[model samples]
Target: MRCKILIATDFSKAAASAADYALQMACLCRMNLAIVHIYSVVLPMVADGTMIFQDSLYDLAEADSLERLSALAAKLNLDADRLCGDGFKPFIEIFSAIGVPAAGIKSFFNRKDMGMIVMGIKPEERYAETLPGSTIRKLIKWASVPVLLVPMDFPPVPLRQIVFTSDFADSEIIALDFLAGIASAYHSDLLIFHNRISMEKGRLFLLKEKKFLDKVAQEIDYPKVFYRHKQKDTLEEALSVMEKNSEADMLAMVHKKHSIIGELFGGDKTLRMISRTQVPMIIFPQSFADIPGPARLGQNQLHD
Candidate 1:
């Protein structure tokens, strides 16, 4: 079976933008894109007691979703009828279920070759403000595949440079190494970005971290991998400054239990770091690098 990039949409503006972004990425990579919308049928009860199956209702809803999906593909100038055995064209798949949204998403991943999950969110101007709540949070935590969070306002630019923020953790290096697809597909330059804490012991820790990053670069030995860093009062502030300096096409981070990801998403500063780049952010699970795939195989070769 052919693999595809799964883009979840709710037909909202944010979702629409995500679909568009996924379409562009899929086209660039010469991969197939599947836009999935999961909906549950709600049938109104009559006074008599019995409820009808209402097949027509579901049919109408499915038709409407397909129509909208077609419109989205049309906007991308993708021909839906053209079938490439590898799923190179854009297609729509509607999953109707009477269960948790996350469960439906998980089911798809279990049965499909899901390269990545791309979701869109509304961009906030301030990071400290109240954050919007949605099923995306649930999906991010539950998904086995990498998740790319694309802000609705972000433009689809060439992914020429990808900046991965590292805390000098081994898991972070593994996560970066796992993303060989994005790098090889775009031929992107990899930036091993780290930020030092100002209040912490200055030169010693700085030298230690620089050496750690250098070791990582040497281990990977990718010609395009480069190291960069900055010292700031806070991790969030340092990330913001680095984003400005790098003009990175994509931002990546490794999410682990009790890591900075937990703190960032748990507090009001979730949007602070996210808003700074306005670029697509890819989140890799700390333990997910071993999964079999071209990317993982490439990482193994690099290690050898």
Candidate 2:
């Protein structure tokens, strides 16, 4: 998995915050970074032929977008690959409308061995939605590699300490070495965490997860590693664990198909977990390996 870092931008100030965080992460990983902006002009209902064709506005947006990206690259002191692509629909739909920002990013970095993607999450604070963009959610769940999400207002700093959430999706994980290697690359302190509930089944599941981790520790020698299994059941309670630790620079998790807890709990649980984390979070797709399920892997109530 050798890929350069890719950061997509929209000239919004919130996006600028994400871009800054990406640069710091890129420098830490020492991976070549490519900053891209996908621009499109939507044809709104114009009463009459007020001006030029809708497509024409793309040029101005493109120019402004480029200037913004350039300024970011310069500020970061990074010589990154910069691009501005054209699309017919809004930027959010460009991915499914045709190819995607992910595909282009994959291909562009493929020649140079593109392997992972890092994107900005968090709504423009004014929007007040805690969820990520539909595009980002799709990519996080579907991307071939890891997609790291940075908060729109994350502080500028290095990603030296990482928290990898362990939901115990499987009895054994074959990728311990892979995870260890990546953690070692960044010289990061790997904090493995687990959230538990009072439910008997959930407790049993956590025990199995602990057993799996113990086996991994015995098999491979991972450095500077620590593990914490929280007895909290609610998402808010799980967040309290993060607040207690308060040392991770990023959050990492495997996107399980049927979270042992159910899709809604497994998924929303992570989102709520993210809500408490000040650092960026990276969701690793479950296809990578078999992990233990949480509590009710395939069952989720509307209230998850």
| Best-performing candidate as measured by lDDT | 1
Q: Model 1, range 195-291, lDDT digits (tens) per residue?
A: 7665546687767777777767766746778877777766677666656766677888766545445545654233345544467888775566556
- List the candidates' TM-scores in order: 0.76, 0.69
| C-alpha lDDT of residue 193 in model 2 | 74
Local distance difference test, candidate 1? 0.64
lDDT tens digits, residues 101-210, model 2?
55545544233344456666655421432544556655655555556677777876555667777755452243344445556656767777767666636567757866
lDDT for residue 122 in candidate 1, whole number 0-100? 69
Worst 10 residues of 1 by lDDT: 295-304
Off by over 4 Å in 2: 44-55, 78-112, 123-130, 170-179, 199-207, 218-221, 258-267, 290-304
Cα lDDT, all candidates: 0.64, 0.55
